[model samples]
Target: MREVEETLAHNLREVREKKGYTLKDVVKGTGYTEVSISRWETGTRIPKATVLYNLAKFYGVSVDRFFWR
Candidate 1:
């Protein structure tokens, strides 16, 4: 589970950076705080399914993108 979380964190950060979006930009679009986003990207916290869905939508990718390939 920890490995899965880490993979998700990496993927999330990668996708965000690839899209040229800052944490503040994600916060504005996803209604998630920068702290929360940071935590998620750092693997210190895991987002709920709905949150994941919302993030996927915001990034224009499938939720599976956050998982190991």
Candidate 2:
């Protein structure tokens, strides 16, 4: 689970950077608070399944992108 969370955090940051988006940009795109997204990216908090799904969908990524090894 810790590995998954860490991977999620890395992936989230990477995905956002790959798209040249700031946390504010993601908030605008996903309607989640910047703080919430920040926490997720920092691995201080994990999103719920629904929230994670929404984020992946908004980013046009598969949910599997958030997990590995």
Which candidate number maximizes lDDT? 1
Against the true structure, what is every candidate's RMSD? 0.8, 1.2
Point out the worst 10-residue segment of candidate 1 by lDDT: 60-69
Pairs of residues clashing in candidate 2:
none
Best by TM-score: 1
lDDT of 1 by residue, 1-69 (tens): 788998999999999999999999999998899999999999999999999999999999999999955
Query: Positional deviation of 3 in candidate 1, in angstroms?
Result: 1.1
lDDT of 2 by residue, 1-69 (tens): 688889989888888898788999998998999999999999999889999899889888888887844
Instruction: List the global CA lDDT of all models.
Output: 0.94, 0.88
Candidate 2 Cα errors over 4 Å, as ranges: none
Which whole-number lDDT from 0 to 100 does residue 41 have in model 2?
93
